[model samples]
Target: MAKQTAKTTKRSLAVINTIQKLGGATLDELTGELEIARSTIHLHLQTLLEEGYLTKEGAVYHIGLRFLNHGEYARSRKKAYTLAKQTVTELSDRIDEEVEFVVENDNRGILVHESFHPDSHFPSKERHISTAPSSAGIYYYLHSVATGKAILAELPDERVEAVLDDRGLPRQTAHTITDQDDFIRELEQIRDRGVAFADEEYVDGLREVGRRVTGPDGSVLGAIAIIGPKYRFTDERYTTELPEILIEYVDDLETEISDSYLDDYR
Candidate 1:
């Protein structure tokens, strides 16, 4: 088969993303969003509709559920997803709080798995988000959220600098670290202790503890975190009890993944 041309691929992907963002849209809405002519949008829509990748109702177009199959297939290939599911559930039950398993992708963290008590309310449950500067102008300060800080701690200095250069250290809260030197010091502390803490730097009333998961060869897989209200996750518990438990869970997960899915590192 021939490879798709860049122009074709770009336009097609943009069209798909536009529909996804709008939830459902008419041809005119898509045309306006994409800045493409009506005829061009209609052509792509016709092709997607014919291929069952999109569906239409009353002149509005929406993404087809067929993408679920593709998403499931992609997720099934990640060993961490399955390994994280059980551990995240147990952590949630153990802490009676919200727990999340996140993986770094292109320097951003994606919430791949999550477990939370029914009564708990976690505002940061977005499926995807930047690990550092959170959406609401709230900086998860790579050193703030346990998961982001843990991963940052394990990375080499040059790589960490690159991430900072690309995404500046913006202050999200009064507690956020705006100075790179101060952030480096914080990362050094986390490395020595093998854990990270959010400390209400990301969200005023929220706190989180995170530990990084590694492969047998010490490749970073991701990080798992226990999150909740600051009132419950006190400074004492965060510095003491919580790190011990989160580290244990991360240890078990790392060992299992290293033994069973070593190929992931390659």
Candidate 2:
């Protein structure tokens, strides 16, 4: 019975993955990919379709809209998302740029929420806002982008080392710091300054400034960033003007999140 259950679970997962990879697939395509009997594949597809997990359109089967409902429900439950929903708009209006609220999920950075100013112009489809990195055409690297660095700065030295070991510092652009020692030193500087800056490291003609917003216990909850083109982000403002204001916004977010979310648990 246990073996039968395990086989069923594996078959279901393989069918879902194959459909996802092909975008939509006919029963023949699924049978060819899985090398399973046509009758068994039809039975599984019928089960999934009856459960509203898959939708059939003539000969092809596609993932159903039920997953979007699940995705939004999961997103709304995050403490970071709840807190950022109320404040990211104001931050975007104040900065006159795109504001991103990103969370550290495992070793990858996930953009949970984003607010854009009326004047903000997202240059490309690849550069627009999204939670999914693949859809957004953005790379997730803790050592490269400002939001990733801000979260990395709050982690202990050992945890940071573990991340480095697990995912080697791959270069995104010429300015990216690939050396482990240099990246460690950069984290130290961010810890001291309470802010992290990515100066054309992640992209050739873009810049970002970020700060970590932590809970009362100093655990990193998320990071907020102000992102824009390099030409608009002058060195003078980045070093002197922006950091102070960015830190103030981050501090306010931290206080609000701590009081509203973390205090309840305590």
Candidate 3:
């Protein structure tokens, strides 16, 4: 029984590794590479798909659209995914942390694109990145994240005040700035610094640093950030890392957005 379990785990990991290496693979390609029995390969693939790590399109087994939902949304922006992806890709490499593109949904900040760490530094022992966005209209408050601060920075004071009035600044942590007046001032600081910081504000032991994602005209479209656990992202590290990464990311996104706008004109 132990041998059977070991064999299954090996085959399962083999199937997963192939998909990871290729980004996507056909059933035939997998069968050729995996020395495991065909039944074993099929079983592992089924499990991977069921676990939301793999997706099959027609005959092509690929990483699922779950990972791309955010990218799709980021792509749908004025610039589209092509440009945003470059920034997203770079952010992941530079920081070795999860990087994402987020946008505003009604009154809430929504994650629209996400890029994961390379297999080397992944937090999960369960192979493959499974992060997916919570759908819109779910009522996550604006003060819940640094992502929110980035979104808020773009707002006119009156509009910002309105959102705050509707959603009181409930504290997520003692570190969270909940006072309306203080929060508004903090938003100004974010604008001046060109970044937003969540010092364990959203989730304790988790931290994120964000900057406003803008369209071609410098209109803030949403927010983007790099995220990780607190152990790896201490405040000092965040201050040193986030702003630089975010600034470069936003610059890349802007170029893509500009080109996308011009494509429409032509």
Cα-based lDDT for every prediction: 0.77, 0.80, 0.73
Please name the candidate that would achieve the greatest TM-score relative to the true structure. 1
Ranking by lDDT: 2, 1, 3
lDDT of 3: 0.73
lDDT of candidate 2 over 1-266, digit per residue (tens)? 54446888788878987997798999999988997898988999999899888999999999987777876786688666777756667888887987777778768787767776666555642453233443322337778889999999999989898888988899988999999999999999999988899998877777889988888778888788887777778977777677787888778877787777756678
> For each candidate, what TM-score against the reference?
0.81, 0.79, 0.63
Model 3: what TM-score?
0.63
Using alpha carbons, what is the TM-score of model 1? 0.81
User: Positional deviation of 49 in candidate 3, in angstroms?
Assistant: 25
Report the Cα RMSD per candidate: 5.4, 4.6, 13.6
Winner by lDDT: 2
In candidate 2, clashing pairs total 0
Q: Tell me which of candidates 1 and 2 scores higher on lDDT.
A: 2
